[model samples]
Target: MSPLSPVLDGPLQRSWPWLLAGALIYLSFGFTEMMGSDLWWHIAAGREVIQQGSPWLVDDWSFTEQGSAWHNHEWLADLLFYGWVRVFGVASLVIWKWSLIIATFCLFQQLLTRISGNALAALLACTAAVAIAAPFLDMRPQLYSLLGLAVLLELTLFRSPRLKALLPLFLVWVNLHGGFVFGLMVLAIVLFPWRECSLAALRRAAFTWSACALICLVNPDGLRIFCLPLVYALNADSPYRSLGEWRSPFEAGGITSAWYAYSLVIGAALSLTWLLPAVRRRVRFSPELVAIAVLSAAMSATSRRFIILWAMAFALLLAPFAGALLRQKLVQPLMLPALLALTIWGGLRVAPYSLSSGIAFHYLTAEYVFPHGLADFVEANDLQGKTFAFYNWGGYLHWRSDGALKVFIDGRANTLFDDATYLDYVTVLGARPGWIETVEDSGAELFMWPRGRNGVRLTRGLLQTGRWRLLYEDVRGVLLAREGFALPVTLRLPDDSVDTQLTAAYLASKKGDTVATLAAASRAHEQRPWGRATCTWLRRSLQANGQLREAESVMEACRAYFPSKYLR
Candidate 1:
């Protein structure tokens, strides 16, 4: 073989075919799953960058906190993702993700190809690459680190034992994503005194390590970005705790999970095997595979999310042994490329990336899915002040709502966000006293409820006794005005015709009595003291609470008796 044989090797020797194969598996796997909030947030963040011409670090539109701390570490990736989604819509976003996966496979193959000189080792390494990278198949900036780290590992570990030569690449990897911490660890591993090789290998590794640190200074945050890992890791209950990916090692379940477990198992066996009184492979796991194995295993077992760590180490471990396992004859070269092309094709087909549509994905501004319609209703009814929201709807409401409507709570889980807030949030909606307490303390001017329920005690209790005015209730959302703001209790006497009639109808509706509903709505129409507006509120309350038929009957009767053209 010539000096550049690895680069110019034959189709069977190149290992590019296996790269295509590994990437194909990932592209295929992701196609069947739904694109989660990560995709939308990327688009949303991009818009912020475009609108502000800079990164965000505070809650701009949020009514609760105007200047809460924010993090834009993945700002660059989000802008690229937003721009792509604008151009091609979801298809473009999908393509970007798939392309990253394919590139990861190609990089892993290329690195191993140079080191092992065995085409089969390159192929197996790529295969192991696919197996390990399974859980990270989302539209997250983290993908940048995933692929970059794979390339970084191959360069630092398998081929040259010199860390200095690998520093420039490490710098690029660091600037690209926070996963650079793992890359730094790889360098330090090579520089350590291990049972693997002679002093010369460590010297080469140490030099590369020094050069890489220098290159890291070129990024935007300077060296501060590199230091953030320790800070973030130590932060209490940062998604790293509750989320499964951040958990301890692999336990069981899922199609792709076992790939990580397999590598941990195989690597431990091989690393221990090196201590045998036989053929010394002149190499040992630099950072002590046993420790990484235990940690990675614990992470995998605790959360499915950190499977990336398990996969990464597995890929590095497989690089040396690829030559032995992947020596089988190439099946069909054409099929491999076909898979690669299809993987790319499928990804582009899924991500909704387009600029002119003006319709952002749910994640981009999830809080504003139907802002105009919902906001107009609130304004027309004068529904404002502190309101309650479901668990994940806080960010959405905060973004879409006007200053009048403050939220009881939206998604920001602040330690300072009083325990009363959290308790009432779950209680009020679930109809659990604290409901009234949460409602009162939030200074709630409106209670937004999901469209149809038997009788949500929080909102219904207020409406039945005239404590709240049914200010706005449509199919999308419900808005109730606290009595003092819109209508005082003195304004609504029990037998005062309109008030009595509407109150009676509300009570019957709550009791599931259809017969009494129609009769009460009739007498209520006869006593329309506030004119058409009161009648309108009655109809809206009935229809919004699943009394559409009674609302129609009241409308018909009001038209027959008063015969006003404006009612139409």
Candidate 2:
């Protein structure tokens, strides 16, 4: 009998309700606020593409590389986002994001079910995969690459492989996102079969692989498309490598989060299946799948971006064993209930944070994560000139100002920026020696910067130079202009929001100005009496000012309002 024959007669045949429940629960995990930093520029770019006839190949959005070549790999995806927003409104992008996520996971579950013949096992594997992938599933072009991979695996790796469909898939995928490189790698791996090394099978796989690769070149980038990944990898001096997503999980610290640890465990388990002959004999995993799983795991270990791919591969490679475990005497009786309970627990944990008041998506500026307020101040004052900005806020500033305010750098990174440009940005941002000179040399009239820990040194340095005058300040960002620069009006502490007060407290604490820290923290606590972070900051500031009794009182209030563990 075929491996899938038993599925028709198994409990899965009657488990539609359970599968539906699992899918809904999985969808809940993604219902958080849309807060991707790069998303703003994407929308802006998409708008430009729709208004114009074609995507701009030159970087006109930044002052540093105004005419530099921009390898716009994700133009198609950006256009789609723009179309969705234009027709259905901005909130629709959230729905679009969740739709892609659900589709990808659905494909994963289907593939797992076909391979393992156990819907319950497939569901459990998908849940584990979701746990690892949830953090990285922001609304971006990368989502297309993820969904593409899922579809590719379903078509190529599952029973009766559809090799011909991959050509068109790659043709479209190359335009959607740069992740088509991974799909090409997977196709190449599948060219060689594990046990049966037939010449005909080899020829077929070779033709499909070559055809898909050539189809990828049909995009706007042409031959340059193939060179993009290489450029990112080979550039040793590129500051983009220092980004958190690019760093290896083993670096700085080893396997910090439970999700990373879980991925490692999955990778190790897959490796052991090949290393141990006994286990290999028991589990009839395809060698190509094993190779793909190993490659994905290694890539994920080296760079965090590949974790979702590894998670998908993990479900594919281990589903059979997961199914076998479910059938075991000890597990079979309790498996269904345990899985349901676990799903419920996960949903409950996520729902509190995921559930929002409304679905109208807005740029996330909370805690200075973005420069929404600074951008507003600049636009309101008609401030225009070369601006030095925090790197993360580059996209938002460009989008919000509609290209009136160009930035030194943005999320485009290697796509438009060279090593020297990024290095200069890094030097000035860190307030390294000669930073003031670098800023002066750039002729930047305005400085749109953060006020948090990352920007504290730079903010202090700008103040000390006595050349940059503060134009605006908020909880998240500070806007400054060169001496004698024109300004319509200056709004200092524009609102008495808790975020502004918290920024004040942090800056004061950094300078060891205990009196200012205490005053700011006290105001912040009053503004946000129930906020855990605000409470903690207030308590610490009070303790620093030698008010032990007041600090104790703040801690007591904090304890009353929040969980004891949160106080710690």
Give the RMSD in angstroms, all C-alphas superposed, for model 2: 4.8
The numbered model that scores best in lDDT is: 2
Where in model 2 is the C-alpha error above 4 Å?
Answer: 1-6, 13-15, 31-35, 87-92, 230-237, 253-257, 274-281, 328-339, 357-368, 454-456, 484-568
lDDT of 1 by residue, 499-556 (tens): 4455567567677776676567656656552235345646765776678888777677
lDDT of each: 0.54, 0.72
Q: Per-residue lDDT for 546 in model 1?
A: 78
Q: Identify the runs in model 1 with alpha carbons over 4 angstroms from their true place.
A: 1-11, 32-35, 113-125, 159-176, 191-240, 243-263, 277-303, 326-388, 394-568
Best-fitting candidate, scored by TM-score: 2
Of candidate 1, the 10-residue stretch with the lowest lDDT total is 355-364
lDDT of 2 at 509: 83
Clashes of 2: 0
